[model samples]
Each structure stands twice: as C-alpha cells, then as structure tokens.
Target: MNPVIHFEMPYEDRERMAAFYRSAFGWQTQMLGPEMGNYVLATTTETETGDRGPTQPGAINGGFYGKHPDWPAQHPSVVIGVDDIRAAMEKVSASGGQVLGEPMEIPGVGHYVSFMDPEGNRVSMLQPLPRG
Candidate 1:
C-alpha cells in the first residue's frame, strides 16, 4: 500500500513561519532561494540525510510553500508515495479522483503531482527516484 510520506502547508512569511516552527517544535528549517521558488524545507526529525526521510518510523516531515493568490485550495495537504505515478494517476481517475495536472520533476527528489480525492480533498503523490 502507498504510504503518506510528506505534508505541505502554505505560509505568508517564510522567516516568520520558520521561526515559529523552530521555537515551538524545534523543527529545523532550510530556506531555499528564488532559484527554487523560495520554498522552505521544514525538517521535523533527525534523519540520516535531510529531505531523504525521517529516521524514526511513523514520523514524517513536511515543507512550506509561499502562498499565492492564483493557487487554488491552498490548504494543508498530505503526500503519498507511489510506486508508479502513471498508473496511480489512472487509478485516481478511475476511482472518481481528479489528477490536477502533469507531474513535475522535483530535481533529485522525484516526479510529483497533486490530485483531488473522491471526497474533494487535495492530496499529492510522489514517485521517488531510485538512489544509487
């Protein structure tokens, strides 16, 4: 079964959000510059490699994105890891879900896409690239 691997939430101020998380939860934050769309990576666990995953089981990390007016349904969402993105997209459609758009490459991360489930909840799926 696919697992819920990551979560995402929109933030208006990157630094303020980072500070709040760091102070409240002691979560580490990495601020990416404009080259990467000003995305802030929020690390919630002690992992062997940042962004790879959480070292502890049942613990997941997430990131924060800059909120945009044009972006629809900017609510907190969970990301599921899938083995085959293409097949998963098909399954979503077949099961009364709607794939948002074409999957996009996330550099060393993987191919990622968002979709709306049968309940109209916005969720994402990711197919991580094989590590050598």
Candidate 2:
C-alpha cells in the first residue's frame, strides 16, 4: 500500500516555530534559505542521509512552510508517496479530486503536487527519486 510519507504545516515566524518544536518535542529543525521558499525541515528521527523520512518504523517526519496569503486550504497537510505521479494525478481527478497545479520538482526529493480530496481536504503527493 502507498504510505503517508511526509507532512507540512504553515508557519509565520520561522525561528519561533522552530524553537518551540525543538524545546518542547526535542525535534531537530533545519531552516532552508529563501531560494527554497524559506522552508523549515523538521527532523524527528535520526537519518543516514539527513532526508525528511524517519529511519525507524512507525514514525513519520514533517516540515514547515511560511504562510502564503493567496494559498487556499493552507492548513496542515500530509503527503502520500506514489510510484507514478502523473497516473496518480489522473486517478485523483477521476476519483473526484482536484489537482491544485502542475507538479514541481523538490531538488533531491522528487516531483510533487497538491490536491483536494473528494471531501475537500487538501493533501499532497510525492514521487520520490530512486535511491542509488
């Protein structure tokens, strides 16, 4: 079965949010620069390559994004991993979901796109790059 691999939440003050998570939950945070949309990567578990996913089973890691005024359904969202993103997009559409926009590359990650499910909940899908 496809997995819920990653998650995202909106943040206004990057530093404050990072500090709160770090202090309260002991989660590590890496703040990405402006070119990467000032995204904050939260590492909840140890990693070999420092990617987002947790190294241990039964655990999941997520990230934080700066809030955008124009974005709709800007609430917390979970990202599901898919083998074929294009085909998944078609299936989502066929199943009464709306693909938000064209897929975008996430550098070392993979192609990703957000969508609204039939119940109107916003979620994302990612096609992870093959590991070498």
Candidate 3:
C-alpha cells in the first residue's frame, strides 16, 4: 500500500512560520530560495543516513510553501509516496479526485504533483528518486 510520506502547509511569512514550528515542536527548518518558490523544509524527526527520511518507521517530514492568492486550497496537506506517478494519477482520477497538473521534477528529490480529493482537500504525491 502507498504510504503518506510527507506533508505541506501554506505560509504567509516564512520566517514566522519556521520560528513557530521550531520553537513549539523543535523542528528544524531549512528555507529555500526563490528558485524553489521559497519553500521551507521541516525536519520533525531524526533522519537516517543521507537524510532520506525519519529513522523511525512511519514518521514523516514536511514543508511549508509560500501562500499565494492565486493558489487554491492553501491548506495543510499530506503527500503520499507512489512507485509510478502516472499510474497514481490515473488512480486518483478514477477515484474521483482531480489531478491538478502534470508532475514536475524536484531536482535531486523526485517527480511531484498535487491534487484535490473528491471532498476538495488538497493532497500531493511524490515519486522519489532511487536511492543509491
């Protein structure tokens, strides 16, 4: 079964949000630049070697994206990991969920895409790059 691997939330003030998470939950935050759309990576748990993910099984990490007025459903969402993005998109469509658009490569990460479930909740999927 596909697992929920990551999460995302919209932030109006990147620093403020980062500080809040850092202070309240002790999460480590890494702020990305404009090329990455000012995304903030949040590490909520101890990671394994190479920082792939949490060392503890089932523990997921998440991020924060800059909120924009043009974006729809700017709410917190979870990201599921899939083996094949195209197949997952097909399943989402078949299940009555709407795939927002074609998946985009996330540099050293993987192909990623967002969708809106039948209930109008925004969620995402990631096809991670192969581990060496």
Candidate 4:
C-alpha cells in the first residue's frame, strides 16, 4: 500500500516548518499539484547510503511537512496504498474502524478518506493514481 503517513504539528506555517526541518535535518519541501493548496512534500538523504531504493525507481521516500495539512488536526490521516479504496474501506469497517468523510478527489493525485481505527486511533489513508 502507498500509505502516506503524516506527522501532526501545530502552526500552519509551511515556511517556518521548512526552516526548522532544513536546519535540523537539511531537508526541503517541493510544492506539488495545481493550486498548490497546502501541498508540500519533503525530501532528504542524510544517513549512510544503504541499498537506496525508491518505491518506484526514481520515487523518493521520507516526506516532511512544515505547515497546515489539508485535513484537520483531529483527523490526522496516514495513507495506505491499496488496489481498491472501496475494498480497503470495507476492510476498515469490518475491522471496527469508522469512515469519517466522503471519499474525495485530490484532482491529479487520487482519492482519500479519514477514519478511526477500532481502537479509536485517528488516521487517514490515500490512494494516489498511477501515472498515465
């Protein structure tokens, strides 16, 4: 699954958030998507080089955030890549999780939803569409 797990923090300041991360870890965010509304992905290569593999070759991992997320703080969501959102959601329900919002589109990205796990962990999931 392409799970987009997020770290929740106060302050909707992406720039300051960027600076903090940049200083602490030497990483940066690259704005993505149309509107660029709250969409920022972080990248870095700090540790000793291991096997160095991208999920999809050139695909970079370890994203960061230094601003407000599109979703609310209580609804903090971490996405899991799945072949089927409907099926995955169904599994979420069967597993005692409650779906919170309507499945929404990220325009060019894909679909997403917020849900609470059986244990009441506020989390979210995303399914990014494949490149044409």
Q: What lDDT is reached at residue 40 by model 2?
A: 93
Which stretches of model 3 miss by more than 4 angstroms? none
Which of candidates 2 and 3 reaches a greater lDDT?
3
lDDT of 1 at 61: 87
Model 2: lDDT to the true structure = 0.92
- Residue pairs with backbone overlap in model 4: 1-81, 2-81, 3-79, 3-80, 3-81, 4-79, 77-124, 78-124, 79-125, 79-126
Each model's Cα RMSD? 1.2, 1.3, 0.7, 5.5
Better of 2 and 4 by TM-score: 2
Candidate 3 lDDT tens digits, 1-132: 999999999998899999999999999999999989899999999998887789999899999999889888999999999999999999999999999989999988999999999999999999999987
* Candidate whose TM-score is highest: 3
- What is the per-residue lDDT of model 2 for residues 1-132, given as tens digits with 9 covering 90 to 100? 789988899999999999999999999999999988999988887765845456798677889999999998989999999999999999999999999999999999899999999998999999999877
Q: TM-score, each model? A: 0.94, 0.95, 0.97, 0.66
Backbone collision tally, model 2:
0
**CA lDDT of each candidate?**
0.91, 0.92, 0.95, 0.60
Model 4 alpha-carbon miss at residue 114, Å: 1.7
Model 4: ten consecutive residues of lowest lDDT: 46-55
Models ranked on lDDT: 3, 2, 1, 4
